[model samples]
Target: MQGSSIAVDKIATELWAAEVIPRVKDAVVYLDDHMAEALHWNRGLAWLLDSGALAVRELSYFESGLSKAEEKAVFIVGEPLVGPCLSRIAAVVRASCFTCCTVITSCPPAAHHSALYGAVPQQELRDSFLHVEEQLLDWMGNMNFSTTVIYAPLALVSVAPNFVIMPQFQDVFPTLPAPQNTNDSCNKELGALPRHLQTSIQSLVGNLCSIMNMLNVKPDVFSLGQTSHFIGEELERCSRSSRKERGLTLVLVDRTMDMAGALTSACDSVMDRVVRVLPPFTKGHSIDVQVDMSSLCAASRSTAESGISNSVAPGCLSHRDSEIAMHHLVTAKQKECLMELNRLLVEWGSRNGLRLDVGGRLTPQLLQKRVNQFRGTSRNVLQGGLLQQVLGVARALSHPGAAKLQDQYGAEKLLLQNAVANGGSPVVQLLRSRHSMGLSLEDVIVLLTLLYSLVGEKALGDDECLLKAEIVQAVYQAAEKDELPLFLHDLLRENVHEENAVLAAVDHMFDVLPGLGSTADTPKHRLLLECSNSGTQPAVYKPLTQQLLHEILQDDPTLQLVHHAGGLTDRIKSGFGFFRAAAKPHPRDNPVIMLFIVGGVTASEAKLAFDVVSSNKINKQVIVGGTALAKPQEQLRLLFQRQFR
Candidate 1:
């Protein structure tokens, strides 16, 4: 279940609906204001374009020759329109089918993307941006039609009610600033951002400040991870209003600092498992996956009316429908999805005059069994077409293949937790026999990255650290001896370079996994290695995000009052004190706790925010925002500098 407050995603979509879309309509109306017979608005809703006499006559001027065509406005959303996107825009602009066209974007124009992150944008990047712009401009100028492009201050996409992402920068990692020089800095280096990234961070800070200002809420800021100091500098530049008694706390963390959280698979999460198992159907910046819904539609009994046609044709799910369905699926837990699906099937069966009973209660397993038994009869076709793929998914979860996959993930997590100090043999065997272990090169790379993040480069000299070194050496050997995947070799060549260079880059690969953990007793192998050989307590392993949430509870000054209240009698006495004192109101009666990851946040990590909020801890809303909702493969690709497909 979700929290009482609006989810981050709903807020974002509503922002577009209430702000961006309305502005586009206003612009259209403003342009038509001077016309003698302008297009009329229907019920003050700009989304519906009404073609007047003048608008219809205007269509004849074009070579399209649609004298009776009704004028419509086509609004496009997406940033930095690429070559194929530009061509599509050109076609729409040239067509007489639509009277007006507008492109609404949140990001900097395509030409500026490279410059925002790099000292100098590559020649290819500049040329590509220019080529796209030139083609669009050529088409617009030749047509002589009125087309407008509006740049909005909208970069955040709320993927769910409480989760936000900037899809454009999904692959971007904040550049590490030059380390501050100091006598004792050999062991611990301070990180800084590049000049371009400084500008980008400042811009982000400015936007955040503006939002805070608009909301009339002063914020207490906490910065952590690799880009902490850089973000702090940007925040310092912005003037803040006086702090209030009750105000929200903003936690900004760099995702790279939590390599373990980003890499680990969440077995209990249905959305996590689906994203992991299913190959994502990527189209430009959108990440989606296909799912069969033939029997699902029949069970819901709304097939024809829904108009969800795909390449599979009638009784099949469409691409757009699949995206919407998956979005809903990811927002809920695995058990919830199965329960709901089973209920729908049972209800539909009763309504359709088919008396279906799986022990008088339809469960996912029993339904799956029945579906298999009824695989190809006329009755099966009439009753529910084909078996619902989701049911098959439920069944597959208990299969040996899924069990083996879970075991592999568990082993990887355990090995990473101990920094391979608990016998690196298992890791070596996994890397050497990856094909049998159901591990890909990317998966092995993730384990290595996590291992490196935990132990870091400094520990390679220690005898215990030699175990991890051997594991790394094994990976290198595996790559050389075995046949590589189509792109794995290229990825290794471009990013890894030589074995020693890669060993050096290990520190840069992932920011040292923060020493923070669920408990002090847990052996945090990384921290102990920093000093010249001192006995430091190991950190108890837990999700970095959960640890962060607990730290927030302990650190927030406002929360301290509620958490440290003496007793019920003391509180009542204070409430009835001579000052006519009432209990201090929690800022906004439970202000939003926004945890924004600087680089990218993973779906598994996002679940932690929901957990904190759902538990009613501190009675506050916890919202997670990031550059992207990263998958393990995406994380690997980002570190290795490969084009994510």
Candidate 2:
């Protein structure tokens, strides 16, 4: 060990804590190649793995591949999936894009994330390598993971290097001239200092690390509260049976390992707004309308990504309306953020690359709190909490694209109908190319994968993953069996409700009709009525008739449901929601609100709103509407926004 050359310092400070997973070889079925509605990101793992690009073990612990059953059962409507693993995968890929070592001799994050797409990062142009601690904590989520994940930054302290060093008692070694050296170059200085002097040198480096920790890393994680502990606890429980006591073989490599992955593409604030509740699986006729419950709320910018518009089907109208405005907000916010990032990148992108700096306190009285947490508590924990909330919105957007925007812009195209065509980023603008993509949203798909596969199945694989996955599937599958019964399919295909039989059956949002078969819209309407009846049912978090607005109205507390057609939440319920900014000079300037109620709304009314939600007197007119007030299923889209854009 003495004669061995060591390069521990830098590696320990930089490598991603995740295991290097083998990239599954995939013959990509481009998201655009297929109708966006026909796709499910959960099946992506199967496609990638089946193609043989990625080997399970070789992938980063965070970079997981999906299983067969998980993929097969995902389409079961009421059993929608949801979790942290997917978010962590997202975080890992994002964090790896920045590289520090231009040389590929050793694996590091910048290099690793770059490797995902087969790209080489010359140097992770740093904007300030802040939040290293937060990212590490995210990778540490509970719910079963063997290997208490290690990082290259930590490994760098121990990994052997090409340079050689001499025995401490005899003589000191000299610094070798390396092409990528950022440290001060020392020319062969071999002075034999006393043991005390050597100890002092060690202390100086150690102290530097301590200072860095104080400045950049977070303090104890307990500050994040019980949920953090809950995740860790879940991980431990899930990992027990999976841990093979036998020593495992592995090597440290980060996303930069896949320079090919990032080549393609890829928050929350103002919490306490949205709310939705449901039975575990898609069970009975019971959806609780929380008279008043505080839930998380954040807006999504509408430039792109979200699949909301008039082209949507009646069933999906509510889904589209509920999301458009919020996503529109996120787009605006991120664009501003992008500008700031671009400005900073010009300055800091070269050194270490910028990390989204958050958390940490500045002075005395401000102790026990981070500046941004608002409450002044730990920011890392809240960030994780935000990830959980974002997961909800993502689960809400994945669609089959049945209501895709058509090529028709007749005398009455809805004002919000062509929303997806709008661009939020230079990259997205190029990707969208066309005006609108009538497809299921990416956010909901990713969310479902995480919820159902990773967290729901507790997919750490360190324990009895086989058993746990089977159990999860069994519970949800039983629900699916009940809903998609053969008789139900026969009824659906018989054109019982709409002109198109299959569409007619789909319109019947319920599994079993509540006595109103040919007369009622079918099971879909029955299911809508069941929303009020979904007691302590396991299907609550599961999929809904329309994955769109059901989750929002049911899950989001801020979601207001009024009997009337038009008005703002603030104007109606003082301080009701966030829209009370300032009065507009003119009524036309009022924001158009797009609201949606799930299966509760009648199919005819849904079709009407789907047709009208996007129409305008002229280009860029704002119209706000969701489920019809007269519709039996009552979660109508209220005038949440003062006026639509």
Candidate 3:
């Protein structure tokens, strides 16, 4: 935490700027052309408003700079523009007096409804698109305003560096039919992955290949899901080429595979911890949390040279800025976050002509005393920087009870240790005294999952199973009574009244953990899982993606693809291999691994992918994507849907 810097290599940064951002820009470029400005979606709207091509009588609270335009030529750029969004836009436009409006959306009709895209046949999907379009046209035709709708398909949204998500396919898991003959109690069998899901992942892999300019190399696919073999097959089908080298390692994981990791607290990640304490403002694919940027804004105003008093807003941080900060903050370790914040504050104070070197450690009282020394921008020279934004983020992360959450995390760790020592009897004790322990029911559930994972169901007797049932029933009651967290409350509640499903999901994590070499007694694994009290994140809590990549690299550091035995003609006839070549072995320099989670991936997992690629152990890179980027609670709820019903 106190080194030159905590080094992290992010290949997604280059991949996004070079490949993903261009696709996004191209999708919305027509809006720029229409407005005759080289600005993005929101910026283009702002420019049009300034130039009189568009107008908004009322300021929109949700959107930054400008809301959906109520007047002429309102271009809405978003993935999967569904009925609700369209209806809202239509309502707003009808309320206005505009004669004509052009509604340019970033998704087509079929793609607008994600379930329609992922669950139906191609012909049916196309027909549904037509039907939706016809209905939309009719709705607009009857309205007061004449509207022209434009559909521009944008299948992927780059949420963070090296992390992309399909906003339309958030519930990819629930849309697919559960395997037949599987019990409602718990079904963890490998079923045929849905074709639409396969095709979607295939398309994504192709995009990555095309963007990276990979040659005739087949991908080394490692599928880690009950139904992810189809995804690997699809990728392998598309990646058949004449190139002799295995270009990349593509890992397809089902989110259901590791329910324990998803359900647990990501104490290492600052964003995960902060989001748990403070609710984020979620709009479309963007998530923004509250922050106190008042001081930062004040500093900005003091340093503005344009003579405009309102150069910066003084309240909440903007969505764009907040997300950007989140990306960096989420990736940083907790101590790293604190260290960086301290550095930024010291730098800001120095620029503002305040001597704030109080024995090299920044304290709350001393920091406040130094802030009081700033009087009317006396000797303030340098322009305001990211200090305010970072300050806001820091304040939000360290909000009231945030420290207590960390303490609670430690307590949970101790509970797990106690359970491990006493053969998971501590969980039963906690169940009896959960309120006295001050543990949330969610945490209790997570503890049960970890206990089951460490000590198998065989070790957990009838009493433990009943304890699980009691916990699940309590959770159901809390959810019914509207006492559960908002994320849990909104989970797709099917016939998920079975305790066996929860235990099955936890056992599934154990089944996969051994394959990833995490169960082995290697020094690295030992050090990783060892206890730590040095104010650093515990090493045991790695993102599953990172662990999978590590195991893959450990076995074959180069990550070469295993070639098919069939010749080129046979492969072509089978239609599973794309490019089978007889060229010399192509040397892979700094290979890339693409990890795609079928259901959804958490921010912590995505951040860990970045860290693994950036690590010096293996010279490689990773890009992680999923059907949707979700929180731990959201993932747990989704897990319940897949496992039970």
Judging by TM-score against the true structure, name the best candidate.
Answer: 3
Q: List the residue pairs that clash in candidate 3.
A: 216-243, 240-578, 240-579, 241-579
User: What TM value does model 2 have?
Assistant: 0.17
Q: 1 or 2: which has the higher lDDT?
A: 1
lDDT tens digits, residue span 165-215, model 1: 665455446433233342323223212234434435544554455455534
Cα lDDT of model 2 by residue, 576-606, tens digit: 5444565422211212212212112222222
Query: What are the lDDT figures for the candidates, one per model?
Result: 0.47, 0.22, 0.47
* TM-score of each prediction: 0.61, 0.17, 0.64
User: Model 2, residue 484: displacement in angstroms?
Assistant: 15
Residue 159 miss distance in model 3 (angstroms): 5.6
